[model samples]
Target: MRAAGFAPTTATYNVLIKAHCSDAAVPIDDAVRLFQNIAKPDVCSYNTVIDGLCRRGRLPEACDLFAEMIANGIAPTVVTYTTVIHWLAREACFDDALKLFDEMSGRGIMPNVVTYSSLIDGLCKGGRAASALELLDRMVRERKLPNTITYSSVIDGLCKEGRLGQAMEILDRMRLQGRKPDAGLFGKLITGLCDSGRALEAANYLDEMILAGIEPNRLTWSLHSKINDAVVKTLCAKGEVSRAFQVYQSMRTRGISTEPKTFHLLVECLSKKNYLEKAAHVVRDMLSERCIPERETWDTIVRAYWSKKKVRQEAEEMWSQLTVTN
Candidate 1:
């Protein structure tokens, strides 16, 4: 352009830099070269360069450019502050991001919804769901209603942290506000319920999703399996062997294949209750399917025999056979 009698201003370079910075598929070196080519760089140029570096995960270089901008008496815009905050958030550096946010405000830069949303997301993602909730309260007190995405993100985080009740409360609030959860948010809720041993509630939620005309995807199916496994394990742990066995059998009728872990857990549970005969039969079934019995399997049977004062010799013989065959 310069050779074609067209002069490129600092703003032109800044625009080019910003464009390159936002393109995830673009190389960072290209943005850096464009910024370097700018002569007599202004605030926009510096902001563009700093944002570009941060976007490329070059935080140190971004900081250096920020410092240089200040040295040159260039005031940063909201976009510049946003770039730094987003970068820090992405790195899980919430403290630094919050400090930068405060500094931006101290410099009289008012944050928009995007800034607040990003900070809230960072806090939630960093496992600070409590803090995120507090921040959301603050936002509400200041008359800023949360968007659906913000609500969903915080709900997902709370659910993942085992605060299923709190997450449900949020979901209820969302519904009252006439906002519905998308598939992803529904998946998270189901997963959280299952993780908390609320398999029945998880199943109910799945039914609710169906009633709402939402089809369960692979993720929902995976959560169903997890919830079923947890229920079976809990039943077994409570010495409800017959119930666990019934649930295991019902899985096949539901088209859910019996996983290896399910067999292991059930066998171990039966053995613990002095049902070595039943445990051995289960082990035989496992081996019949070419699933080699784990050491824990042998140990369970041995302990079962020892518990009943039956025969350590038989236990030893079984152990020897397991070692040779397995």
Candidate 2:
């Protein structure tokens, strides 16, 4: 356009700057040069360049340009404040980020959901979940509905802080607001509950997760297996053999592999309960899955069967069959 004798306007330069900033192969310095050449830079021009600087991890330069924009009688827009606050939060400059947040609010600029979400995420990552929750409350009071990312960050932070009860309340609130919790979110809650020795509650959440139809995808499969294994093992240790067996069945039905320790626990607990037939079936499954049951597990099953007067003959025949199969 310039070669065709048409001078590029500020809008045209702004577009070029944004393009250059977004493309990793293009040097940010080139975008800065183009921005510098804009004769009458507007709010859009400043926002574009500031965002570019932040994206390139040049926060100090971005802040300086921000101040320059304000000093030149060009009022900063919501985008301007949000961009700076987001980067400040990302760089773990929570004090600066919060100061900018208050500054924008004091200037009568209302923050949007993205602004709140960014700050919430940053605060959560910095282990300030309680503070993040306060922001979430204030955000609701200001009538800004929290999105999935907002809720997720708060819940994850709460879980990390071992404030699981609050996390659960947030999850319930999220659901009431019609936001369906994903597997990762549920995994966080379940892991937290399990770590706190609340396996029973964790198992209940796992059931709720399944009932909610949140199937584990490739990304969450490992987490699914891990939580299930933990719940089953803990249940067995707590002598809730019946519940453990139910969970084991659920894992198998879902095609989730049970860990060897979990399988062993189920077999041992079932034998103790004198459920000889079920115990033998689990041992058979162990063999089928190439999970060799420990010798103690075999002894438990054999002893349970032999100790039962009603199933003595069946025990002998079953033992022969198992030995042959193995």
Candidate 3:
């Protein structure tokens, strides 16, 4: 257009600046230079450049440009405040982010979900989940609905602090609000409950997670297996062998591999509880999976079977199979 003797207007320059900022191959400095050349920069021009600067980790320059935008008699919009707040939180400057949040509110600018989510995320990461909870409440009161990322950060933070009851409540609230909890969210709560010695509750949540239809992705498949093993092991330790067996069955049906130690514990516990048939079934499964049962586990199953005359032949066959497999 310039070669055709048509000077590019401010609107044309703004479009080019935004395109440059978004393209990784083009340096952000080019966008800044174009922005500087705009004779009459509007709010869009400043917002785009500020966002680009933030994306490049140039927070100080972004802030300075933000102040200059204001000094030029150009009023900053909600996008302006949110961009700065998001970057401030990402950089771990929670205090500065909060101050800006208050400043924006004082200026009668209503914060959107992105703004609240950013601050809540920052607070949660800073070990102030309690404060993040307060922000969540305030956000709801202000009629801004928290999305998955917002709730996830708060729940994870609460779990890390061992405030599991609150975490569960937030999870429930999230569900009621129509947000589907993913495998990672359930995994965090399960891990927290297990660490708190509340294996029974953890086991219940595991069932809920499966019932919720949250499919484990490649990244979370091992997480599901690990937590399932933990709940089964803890249940066995607590003498809840029946429940442990149920969970173990679920794991197998889902094609999740059981650890050798967990398999042994289940087999041993079933034998001790006089469930000789179940013990033998578990032993067969262990062998089929190529998991070598402990010698004590073999002794436990053999003794239980031998004590019952009705299954003495079964016991002898099991010993033969074990000998062959070994």
Total backbone collisions for each predicted model: 0, 0, 0
Clashing pairs in 3: none
The CA lDDT at 211 in model 3 is 92
The per-model lDDT (C-alpha) reads 0.77, 0.90, 0.90
Rate residue 252 of model 1 by lDDT.
43
Question: For candidate 3, what is the TM-score?
Answer: 0.83
Error of 1 at 281 (Å): 23
- Per-residue lDDT for 212-292 in model 3, tens only? 886567788898888899899888888888988999999888888898888888888998899878889899999998888
Best by TM-score: 2
Evaluate model 1: give its TM-score.
0.64
> Cα miss at 154, model 3 (Å)?
1.2
Task: Tell me the tens digit of each residue's lDDT in model 2 across 201-238.
Answer: 88899999999998768888887898788888877888
TM-score of each: 0.64, 0.86, 0.83
Candidate 2's TM-score reads 0.86
User: Where is the poorest 10-residue window by lDDT in model 2?
Assistant: 306-315
